[model samples]
Target: MESIFHEKQEGSLCAQHCLNNLLQGEYFTPVDLSSIAHQLDEEERMRMAEGGMGSEEYRTFLQVISNALSVWGLELILFNSREYQSLMINPINEKAFICNYKEHWFTIRKLGQQWFNLNSLLTGPELISDTYLALFLAQLQQEGYSIFVIRGNLPECDAEQILGIMKVQQQQRPKLIGEDEAQSSGQGSVLEAGPGVVEGVVDEDEEELRKALALSRQGMEVEDEEADLRRAIQLSMQGKALLGKQP
Candidate 1:
């Protein structure tokens, strides 16, 4: 006898089986659930909600998306946290995007709420408080683009790991090629003495000081212009005292 599953519906039976296995230790694969109906049907609702699913984290997630998602006629398939950000399907394009929480409006999509909630759990509900998702959402919303949410079928990630991804994703765009080339050209000269280093010789002020001190030597043998040299040293020192070290 042919099973009722084949004749009656395409996805419902497989989804039920997948959901059952998911509640057990068996992992849910998209391939396994592909032919199944959306598992968010009301019968799977749990009464023994224990941890974060019912906690403030979930509440904050709700508060954020409450304006954009609805609680009606939708089921959330709870999974462990993963590395990716979660998303709600766009109503127009059917693509997924990071969601925005407003006060009281909801979308026409069934999976949108669950997707937001799942992403909230994975990325931390506080992702709503961040500017990156907000800005991205604003851009998408303005552009009429849709975004898909990544449903986590994976394990929990640490804060450091999650934040590192966020930081890289949030970095500013790099310099343009023209600007980069210009900057390189500006700095392309050979490394030379800067303000502090004397070019090709010892510092003039230090040289003058050495000459003045040397001219004061009692046993000097130079006869030509030793007095002139002494006077020149005095003049140089006086100039340095007035003008300070020059390049």
Candidate 2:
């Protein structure tokens, strides 16, 4: 844990933090991303001038930011890519995932067999259990987040090397930055009850979070079943037609 490199939220630099955290280094800056965006802009304009219809996305910067990631050998594959559905169904080899909800971007990555939530909004890196990974991702998808599988090699860090041989368990979950202050202001009585009482309250909250994840997973499963049933019906109909046409 001591070797883990974490950068708390700073201004609107979540993109920078997300990338640096995934790569396990201070490898990119605003200037670098800006340079990439400029290059993309020039290329887009060139294509437009060449009589090709080019799409310009000014509503959001995600497209430009994703291109910036490519400069570092990082490729963001859509979680819902039809071509990669099998891979996502059982993501054993996945190294990292970047998620976007509206304009906010965050990353979830695996290091030394442990998964961590590297969201800038959190107070620090969150240690996520392997058992909870699929539920967590399914919940995010239900909540309108566009998840992308990060494909490429990530630079190794001290934490990864150390944890490879020794696994660490998280006793407490990471909270959003300023969460304590908000809780203190609104629930002063709860704080006065001591640390044990606080843990109880956190437990109740965690239970609710788990329930939401379970519900999301159930919904996804139901959808998949329905799709399979529809496909079977179509195939049965086609088989019947062929039988009727047989001489």
Candidate 3:
């Protein structure tokens, strides 16, 4: 049967490249899935029922990817059709397996059922963004933009640099920059739904101030409210360090 994704060039290329990389023993660990799985252990799974990883849907999905990587190769395109479908190119057997998604999911379990490690070679940014868009239901409000999730540990200064490289490669076409007037007149921008904040909300300064105000009730005998102000500034500076920002 003709796959629904047969005509999609990027999808095919991505699948092929992924499979080829896997054959060369070049595969990246899937961090997002790993994170999701940690909280879905058997005890937690039974508690949550449908939402947790214990659910049939989640387990099946995880297994399918794992098994495909183990046997055929890691490079795969999991396509959604009226029925779930998978096209996995096996590097060892030099064959393609067209299987139902559910079956593929079952197959991965036959291999080690542990979570995919995160600290291992991580997935590239483009794929990461694709995962974010799919999982988060981020809408692209404009013409040609994408979104991806970054680890909480990623430094804010480096996020843009990493994301920029990924975006450029994912979109091989030349970038076009035009005046605001162009957009107002006819140019349209593609605005993708953000991957949500990677780091916590920058409330260090505010939190510091709150703490300082609370400390005032400690009866430290501040010379005056002005002394309290100075203490607040100091506390705020300390909080700024947590955010990796200069005060």
The lDDT of each candidate is 0.27, 0.59, 0.26
Per-candidate RMSD, Å: 30.7, 15.5, 21.5
Candidate 3 positional error at 40, Å: 22
Off by over 4 Å in 2: 39-60, 186-247
User: Candidate 2 lDDT, tens digit per residue, 118-203?
Assistant: 87666678776676677667666655566789888777788889989998876654554544553554432343221112322344
**Which 10 residues in a row give candidate 1 its minimum summed lDDT?**
1-10
Question: What is the model-wide C-alpha lDDT for candidate 1?
Answer: 0.27
- State in Å the error of residue 148, model 2: 0.5
* Stretches of model 1 off by over 4 angstroms after superposition: 1-28, 38-129, 146-155, 158-247
lDDT of 3 by residue, 50-116 (tens): 3433466545544534554544323333333222223342222221222221111101100011111
Q: Return the lDDT, model 3, position 197.
A: 16
Ranking by TM-score: 2, 1, 3
Per-prediction TM-score to the true structure, in the order listed: 0.19, 0.65, 0.19
Clash count for each candidate, listed in order shown = 12, 0, 11
**TM-score of predicted structure 2:** 0.65
Model 1 residue 48 CA deviation in Å: 36
Across residues 198-234, which tens digit of lDDT does each residue of candidate 1 receive? 1224355543433333323322344524533432233
